[model samples]
Target: MKIQNAIEAKLSEAFDVRILQVENESHKHGVPPNSETHFKVTLVSPDFEGQMKVRRHQSIYKVLAEELAGEVHALAMHLYTPAEWDAKGQAAPESPNCMGGSKKDPAMNAQGDH
Candidate 1:
């Protein structure tokens, strides 16, 4: 299964999911074309009602342990209970642009003049 679909399915099976969005953010990062190294996930579920944020994140990480250890380079998660989702107007924050090795450092840009 595609990584995004796999995440959705797993979370659905694991919880009473109200909303789930798995975004492949590889293109925003500096990975090769068609890479699935980075991701953003937003999950809303009743299972998260009494859980702490850390606990919620742990659950997801546990479910995706294999992918985390191997294929996935970064996993950005925004987990919420149904009420929290509603409070936030049902929107997850967008992922930031890549600033890893592939992104040029402004300080280093003047190197060519030296």
Candidate 2:
């Protein structure tokens, strides 16, 4: 939770945060147990009001540069203005299941071996 805590603190200090959720989703991926490599952040802030979607993402990336450059492998961000959150019923989209790093049986890849 160390990384998650740092992200929450930094974002709160950088923006007028109305709503924020930081979820550690590394377990959902093919990493070791209790890993902190993946995260999903949902943030609603007035600071995003005039910003474009790319800009909002950029701001977050900039704020969490250290984390991104290090242990953090993936960041799924759902950023919105207060009005946009309200319009969307104040919910972020779900993260998709992880599809990488899983091992498969060699027989499964045998082609035309029947």
Candidate 3:
């Protein structure tokens, strides 16, 4: 099974999710082509209600421990409760590309010349 599908299955089993989108963002990173090491996830569930941001992230990390340790190198998560998602008009922001490391252009560097 694809990593995204696996993650979705796990989340669905663990939470009463109203919305879930698992995006394979490895292509936008500075990794080898077709790498599945990076992902962006937007999840809306009552399980997240009243939870702090760190707590929400921790919950997801705990659920995805194996994937984080093995297949996934990085994950950008946008987690919200159903009410929170409704208040925000149900629009999840897009994750920007990972522009760190030698892949970033020198001109965009804040420290000026390396």
Candidate 4:
């Protein structure tokens, strides 16, 4: 099975998930071609009903220990319980570009005038 599928399966078994979206975001990062090293996961599950954000993330990390150690280099997670997801209209906001020119470093552009 593919890495993303493996991750989804593991999470599904560990939680009573209502929604799950595992996106391969390696292409957006500054990595070698065909690198399946990074990902973003958006999951809404009943298991997270009364959990804090940190706890929710910890639970997911615990379930994905093997993938975290072996295949995945980086993971950006947006986890929510069904109620929380519904409160926000069940839509996840778009992620802004991280590696490209979207973020400008002041130190890098030391010359004040652009």
Candidate 5:
């Protein structure tokens, strides 16, 4: 909850948002129960209107660098302008189920592995 709040506060402060969702999707993944390590952020803002996809992701990554570096294992981002978000019915794609790894590796932080 702390990480989620921090992310929301930082992004809301930095951008002018029409709609924002910071979801802790750790449960949908295969991480330990209640772990705040996976997330999905849907941000609808005018700031993304003219930005490229890579740039949008980079901006978010930079803002959540601290969380991503330690607390967060993966971040699924959905960035859009208000128009784009409205066009899509204000919905983001659901995350897929996680398939656990056969061999455990501490540094293997795979988004797909959850």
Candidate 6:
């Protein structure tokens, strides 16, 4: 949980955070058990009020650059301002199931077996 802790700490310090959830989703991916490679973050802050979606994402990327450069392989971010969160009924969209790695079903492969 070191990486997750770091992410939470950094983001909280960088923004006026209202609600923050840092989920470790590595188990849902192809990585080994207990890995810290995949994550989903739900961040609601007044700081995002004037920022575009890309800008919000870029800000987070900058804050978590160390984690991203190391073990974190994927980050799914749900960012919202207070008004947006209220409009969305205080919910972030669920992350889709991971489709990469050897765990992919053969039938779902884009190319059929040779």
Best by lDDT: 6
| Clash count (model 2, backbone only) | 0
What lDDT, from 0 to 1, does candidate 3 have? 0.84
Question: In model 4, which regions exceed 4 Å deviation?
Answer: 100-114
When 1 and 6 are scored with TM-score, the better candidate is 6
Worst 10 residues of 3 by lDDT: 105-114
By lDDT, the candidates rank as 6, 2, 5, 3, 1, 4
Q: Which scores better on TM-score, 2 or 4?
A: 2
Which lDDT tens digits does candidate 4 get at residues 1-114?
Answer: 388889999988888889999888876755556767788999998888878889999998999999999979888899998888999999887765655422265553343211
lDDT of 1 by residue, 39-84 (tens): 8989999999889999999999999888889878899999999999
- C-alpha TM-score for every candidate: 0.87, 0.88, 0.86, 0.81, 0.84, 0.89
The runs of at least 3 residues in candidate 6 whose Cα sits more than 4 Å from the true structure, single-residue gaps closed, are 105-114
Q: Which is the leading candidate under TM-score?
A: 6
TM-score between candidate 1 and the true structure? 0.87
lDDT of 1 at 69: 90
TM-score, ranked from best to worst: 6, 2, 1, 3, 5, 4
lDDT of 2: 0.87
What ranges in model 1 sit over 4 Å off? 105-114
What's model 5's TM-score?
0.84
Candidates 1 and 3, the one with greater TM-score: 1
Model 3 stretches astray by more than 4 angstroms: 105-114
lDDT of 2 by residue, 22-97 (tens): 9999877666778888999999999998899999999999999999999898999999999999999989999988
How many collisions per candidate?
A: 0, 0, 0, 0, 0, 0
Predicted structure 6: lDDT = 0.88
Q: Give the per-residue lDDT digits (tens) of candidate 3, residues 56-75.
A: 99999999998999979888
Q: After superposition, how far is residue 33 of candidate 4 from its true place, in Å?
A: 2.5
Candidate 6 differs from the real structure by a C-alpha RMSD in angstroms, to one decimal, of 4.4
lDDT of 6 by residue, 1-114 (tens): 988999999999999999999999988776666888899999999999889999999999999999999988899999999999999999999998876744566653334211
Better of 1 and 4 by lDDT: 1
Cα lDDT of all candidates, in order?
0.83, 0.87, 0.84, 0.81, 0.84, 0.88
